[model samples]
Target: MKNRWIALYVENQVGVLAKVSGLFSAKSYNLQTLTVGTTEREDVSRMTISVKADDTTFEQIKKQLNAMVEVIKVIDLTTMPIHMKEILFAKVFNLNNEGKTEAFQIAEVFDQGGNVKIVDIGVDSVLFQCTLTERKNNELITLLKSRFKKIEVTRGGAVAVESISSSCR
Candidate 1:
């Protein structure tokens, strides 16, 4: 199975998010990530969703989503040029000065024209915040888990938009 991306424009009304997400749950589709936000039109909202499925399953998912009343439109983005990013925060605990410095250095290495920064530092803890592609965020999490004994991670679902320039993730 491969990952597929989709963008849904839905009505911005009560129970819309629940109904949309419930469809996935009812169909037993493993939703990898889902992010929703209001658009320029207050009456509409856009949702960016990712799922792992084979071609047939992905097509079925699209059909099912399109049949939903609240879903105004569904755009398959798997092969399209788009830009995407996910928010990740990693907080390392029980750190010493050396460890804190190491965390800062690691963040710098990952920054490379991206948004990765040591947002917070305490006596024994440091927090790294990053806005990057989902895959990159996973790599950063893996690295932090390996280096730090005590760590906390929080991740936001990815948000994506059609690219006007070059394709990006």
Candidate 2:
């Protein structure tokens, strides 16, 4: 199955997040990523969700979400032109001077116009913070894992918005 994306407008109420996530769990639909935050309107929240499913399953998911009372609107974003990014933090330990330099070089190479940077550095560890598309973040993580023996990684779910003029994904 390929990845599908949806944007949900929901009431900003307590337990709304839990109920929305529970629906996915109860249906056994695998949610790849889910990020939610309040919109400019304080009473509403926007959620960007990613799931891997076939076309039919994806349609069902949309229908189910639309039927929920808390869900004000559901927009299918899979084929839409949108800009998306996920936050990633990676720390590599047991690094010497050369290894630390290598880490800096790697961050520079993946900078994408300054979206990646060395956020912290210690005698034996270096932390890299990156904001990039999900695919790019995955590639960075893979490279870091291959190059370092002791590493820790944390990732935030992707957030996306419709492109204003140009097409992007």
How many pairs in model 1 have backbone atoms within 3 A of each other, for residues 3 or more apart or on separate chains, i.e. clashes? Answer: 0
Candidate RMSDs in Å, in order, are: 1.1, 0.8
Instruction: Write down the worst ten-residue block by lDDT for model 2.
Output: 160-169
Q: What is the lDDT of residue 54 in candidate 1?
A: 98
lDDT of the candidates, in the order given: 0.93, 0.94
lDDT of 2 by residue, 16-121 (tens): 9999999999999999999999999999999999999999999999999999999999999898899999999999999999999899999999999989999899
Per lDDT, the best of the predicted structures is: 2
- What lDDT score is found at residue 50 in candidate 1? 93
Clash pairs (backbone) in predicted model 1: none
